[model samples]
Target: MSGGPAVVTRFAPSPTGRLHLGHALSAVRAHDLARGGGGRFLLRIEDIDGTRSRPEHVETILRDLGWLGLAWDELSFQSERLDLYTAAQGQLADLLYPCFCTRAEIAASLSAPHGPAPVYPGTCRHLSPADRRARMGQPHSWRIDMARAVERAGPLTWHDAYAGEVIADPLAQGDVILARKDAPASYHLAVTVDDAAQGVSDVVRGVDLFDATHVHRLLQALLGLPTPRYHHHPLIVGADGQRLAKRHGAPALAAMREGGADGHALSDALRRNMLPAGFRLGEA
Candidate 1:
């Protein structure tokens, strides 16, 4: 780790599910990175999805982290920062537009053979003033005008500890949602704002979000927010050679704790890159 600003890292997990081994690895990495640098580690609950987030899950998250001996300097919840996200959306108003497309409609539009997740085609980008006015009362999400935003921000770049300097290409995921009808902020918008607001200097997480960093870099540029150095670590995979998830029967940290498994030992094992019988780290 190069010497500079005091590292500020965060373990941000959504309260929609319990902490699994993958989450444990991420949290321990972020915690160690901050503490090792004589910096700060924060615990943030990403509960922006009101429909899925639950209070019970949040409690379990705190309990699990405590058991693992990862004490945080600060704690926060995304649900409590609605105004910040709203303010960010306001700042980017000129580069945003209302998107009223439903999931079914979007899926139908991209019925042709494509990638696992198809980029959204701008169906409502060129709507006339009257057309937009007529749909103002309908449920809608605010999406970034990718072309205009990129043009305004010019070229952009961000650094990852593993991948080195990366040229941002936010255009690949066209017009992503910034605010949703159900939630005040989408993951992309809220995370960018929160990381900046919390002064996170080092973002340590799984490699699954490497591509998402491109979009986040663009957002930081557009919002005039500082970009943080990222560390996209490999994911914990099961014996089946798949990333662990609830569907794969990934055992939760809560279960381990209840079973009287030693949390410190588990944390040490993870930090030392030691895994249980059938688990290993891999880019999934």
Candidate 2:
């Protein structure tokens, strides 16, 4: 099957919020990439964040996709695949460590300018056995030891359709959380596991996650998963030159559809790279 059909693509969206125009563009891009070439288009619900994800939003997602004339060949839910994430976490035991630092504590301990997210200072990374034993049963999160993980994985690179071959620098993000007390897996871990498990050959998403691809590439190497070709597309922003978000009051697809906008017309416009009034495309 060396040349069997085109590579499979997916549109994995979180059910935490309503699908907006930006989301539609991403879904349409992924869907067209697969369907236009006679390949399969898969849909995966990234509902790992149970606190925010809502059933209503999931239903809206389905309806929105249908309205957009998009159909996926297969569907998957992350909530139902806990065992897979757990198994992947176990495999990285050698490169994982417990992070007992609270958000406030981390903020107070940062002496260097680590930008928006204060890179974890590794305060509890080398805690003595006695200290760890005394703090047993305390709420904590699991983080990958970036230094060790990078060393173990050696030099790694991933091919991006837009950027070409890119070298991975996982340490740039520091020790990203892999597991929390409430959630078994983080975005980095779950996404890496799911893409591999679902046999995703192409990753099409917004460029805002371009930097994250570096960490994912490293994780794929460490987890022995095949690296998928990436295509980080530009994001759709409002006329204010800001990326659309809930706070920005970007109109949701459901709202537009309810407002009498034709679904097929909208889809056709997006396919032609046209944005709605007061919205424009920008690279992330």
Candidate 3:
């Protein structure tokens, strides 16, 4: 914990599944970061995906974190913050365009011969005003014009504890979705907005989101939000060297808690980087 304003960190997990050891590692790290700096730890339920987010899963998350001897200073649910996200999107209206391309259409476009690092080919980026107006009745997602956005917010950068200062290159990711018909806000938009709203000064999570931080830094500049110092820690992996997930048979925290495992002992082990058998931390 470096010297700065009191650190406010969050463990925002989607309530689509149970909390596993990997999730435990993230939560403990965030908790320690906040507590170590005499700051606040927030428990935010990223239940923006209405279809997949279940109330039971959220309950299990609470139980799991509690069983691990972790406590949060505040709690929030993304489902209740739709209005804030919508307002944030409105502020970036000039940089956004409606994307009419379906998943199948985008996949087909990417399948053709293209650059080594494939991204959205800007299929709907050049639509005429009349064409866009005519398609207003159809379902579509709102995508940010990456080139225009980059030009508007020039020479953006953010600091990471591990990666150091990073120059933002959001253009490589193409026009990313801000809003969709199925969801009021995309992951990128919602998390950026929520983090700012919560006054999170230190973002501690997995290194996998390092690239996404580039886009987030740009968004913070565009939206006039503060850029929080980031710490993208390594991910916990199983014997196969794959990140822990339900598909990989990662044991859920609830299961371990229910099985009479010592919560504080497990928490201490994770803090000391003592992983269970056949598990280890890996780089992104």
Candidate 4:
């Protein structure tokens, strides 16, 4: 929050699987943005989803990044900092309500037959905390208090390096998930808290999450966080023009390693795509 022209950016990754093309692009862009400004690039392990997160995955990520030749100035682990995430959860406790509405319930509540976005019917937003806790003891997910959040902060803006200006309405994204039905903390809550605490000035990621800016902006405003610049690069899609997903299968980094595939080639490809060789933020 107390910085000048130096851009402090971070590249966060989840340790659920081997790094893919999308991850490579995000890491490279983040590295370029921070180094481009003669600033700092940080690495954050987003292992909020305890179920799928594995220690081996974390180790492999470090290996993958080293192979890519992408450098970082700082490193953080979301799992290691549970207290922060817990504090944010407490801040959002009453502010956030328990969502007992299952997917079936939400779908049934969709009254706008032809609306572009399926609006929430506010099925569980009005539950008392005690009642919510009781239901949560059984099973539930938690959402932010959009009504209170909007009242606290008006509409916020996000400036993207790739896209133009962007504005978001928190009310539309009613009650986003800060915690899952099973886990206590969520990716959104952990990422926002980490970014705010680290004074991250720039966010570089794949354009596929362009809409997520709205959610992140809302979190920043609600939590009184410093708004950071966002830069979502073009996603690397398959020949079908679809995002790289596990279904279609990406060449696992382990598989590549066994095949004698060099890791630097990944970053080299990324450099060729957007930034030139040896190009930093200032030069970019």
TM-score between model 2 and native: 0.95
Estimate, for each residue in 134-177, the C-alpha lDDT of model 2 and write its tens digit: 88689989999899999999999999888899989888888899
lDDT of 3 by residue, 103-193 (tens): 7788787757544335778999889999999999999999999999999999988899988888888887888899987899998999999
Model 1 residue 133 lDDT score: 92
Q: What lDDT score is found at residue 80 in candidate 2?
A: 97
lDDT scores in order:
0.92, 0.88, 0.90, 0.76
Which candidate gets the maximum lDDT versus the true structure?
1
Q: How accurate is candidate 4 locally (lDDT)?
A: 0.76
**Against the true structure, what is every candidate's RMSD?**
1.5, 1.8, 2.1, 4.9
Tens-digit lDDT track of model 1 for 1-284: 55777899999999888899999999999999999888999999999898999999999999999999899999999989999998998899988889999987888998584565668899889898799999999999999889999899999999999999999999998889999999999989999999999999999999989888989999999888999999999999988888988656798999999999999999999999999889999963
Clashing pairs in 1: none
Cα displacement (angstroms), candidate 1, residue 87, comes to 0.9
Model 4, runs deviating above 4 Å:
1-3, 108-120, 128-136, 274-284
Clashing pairs in 3: none
Where is the poorest 10-residue window by lDDT in model 1? 111-120
Error of 2 at 127 (Å): 2.0
